[model samples]
Target: MTLSVRRARTNDVPSIHQLLDYYAARGQLLPRSPDELTEHISSFTVINEADNLTGCAALEVFTEDLGEVRSLAVRDAATGGGYGRALVEEIEHNARTIGLRRLMALTYVPDFFARLGYGVVAMNTLPEKVFGVCVTCPKFRCCDEIAVLKHLD
Candidate 1:
């Protein structure tokens, strides 16, 4: 099964949300609103098979040297087919092209990112993501997600 990614558009928002929600509901990811998705549409890329959006990921720039890979989700039926890794690679490539020195992610599946060359890091190491997103997370006081970083330099 060959899958390809493309920049997300306005019409892709619903499908993207649905994909993310699948994982979010299971506590694997944070939930995002359609409005938020729409607002950050340009930050997203979707993997499509035929006419369906099966996976989605976003790169959120926090500083000149740091960016966070967030909101990554693949349809349940599509997991383990490498859609997650592909989506992450797409974001990682974009990060390098845009000159970011490091990419960070807070994820439940640290092993998955590790296989892609990310190393676990202390959450304190990413103050930008901690203060920007984690502070607002309902699980802020007890975030179980592992922090991982991949240096592009």
Candidate 2:
């Protein structure tokens, strides 16, 4: 695979939204609004193959020691090719570079994150994301997503 990860530009927002929507529609991820995407564009990294965006992920820093990996999605055609892992690795590197002590993700694919060094943790363990975002999420009252965290050195 010639896929490469890079910081997203403003123009990439639409494509990133589309990719996330593709997964959201199928219940693979939560759909984010264009406004939110634009607001957090700098936190994103896209997997590009040639001129196409094959997958995307975002690193949302909550505190000095923590960043959450959210909005991860791989195009259906590109699934099973390690793009998801690549995206998370990219985010993990970003977290480490910024001196975060832990990288977390709330996901339906815990095993995938586990393979990438994340461990299942209690939902309440991440109070920042939980109280900051989950309280407003539709699934907040009955969230089924698994929370995973990877400690950084």
Candidate 3:
């Protein structure tokens, strides 16, 4: 089961949306529309195995020193095989390449992120995230997502 991560192309948007929708329905992540995925396609990377998309993640810059890892999802059939970790690493590599000093994620799987060197943090510490994305989230006031951050510097 060899998998490779590469920058997402327009053709991958449908698969990306499907993957996110799966996790989103389970409340593990947020749902993204195909249009939204296409708009930010360049910020995303997808894991592929023999022409099949197995997983996807995105690095979205919010500030000079901050970025968010969004829409991370692995296919149901591909879970527990290191695809998620690989996608996260690929996003981190992109964050470092773009000179971002920190990367954050609002996730239900905090322990998974913690194992990857991210520390749990207070949501208030990320005002940009709170005011920008959180405010628009349906779960805003009752948000159950945990904030985790990894410093690249």
Candidate 4:
């Protein structure tokens, strides 16, 4: 079967949460509540290969000109299978469709994003994210995730 990214469905919540939780448990990502996931499910996308969930991501709009690539995770077994790249491409397409000029991500895998045309950026440059969301994170003062940005065309 062909693998493609699709809008997330409510039924995908459990699997999405499990995939995200796997990363969160290792501090690679922040934990997301099921309620939050359900509430913003419309912002998410998923990749299912032959009925097995391979990966997921969400495009979180931060402002009229900016959007974020959040909750990006690929199943352990699918790490090298291009699922992550596919999800990011879908998020980029969605962001451009919505008229967003920039897409940013705070990622542990900067190289992965860089390969997708994203450039490393200083966290302070994104005040909207730094003040709006990152401030409340437990790792606020010590956040280690690399910030990357891609200007959408």
User: TM-score of predicted model 2?
Assistant: 0.95
Candidates' lDDT values, in order?
0.91, 0.91, 0.91, 0.94
Q: Native-vs-model 4 lDDT? A: 0.94
When summed lDDT is taken over every stretch of 10 residues in candidate 4, the lowest stretch is: 77-86
Better of 3 and 4 by lDDT: 4
What ranges in model 1 sit over 4 Å off? Answer: none
lDDT of 4 by residue, 16-115 (tens): 9999999999999999999999999999999998887899999999999999999999999879988888999999999999999999999999999999
**Candidate 4 stretches greater than 4 Å from native:** none
- The local lDDT score (0 to 100) that residue 105 gets in candidate 4 is 98
Which prediction has the highest lDDT against the true structure?
4
Model 2 regions lying over 4 Å from their true place: none
Question: When superposed on Cα atoms, how far off is each prediction in RMSD?
Answer: 1.1, 1.1, 1.0, 0.8
lDDT of 1 by residue, 12-78 (tens): 9999888888888898989999999999999998999988999999999999999999999988887
**Candidates' TM-scores?**
0.96, 0.95, 0.96, 0.97
| Cα lDDT, model 3, residue 3 | 70
Candidate 1, run of 10 with poorest lDDT: 1-10
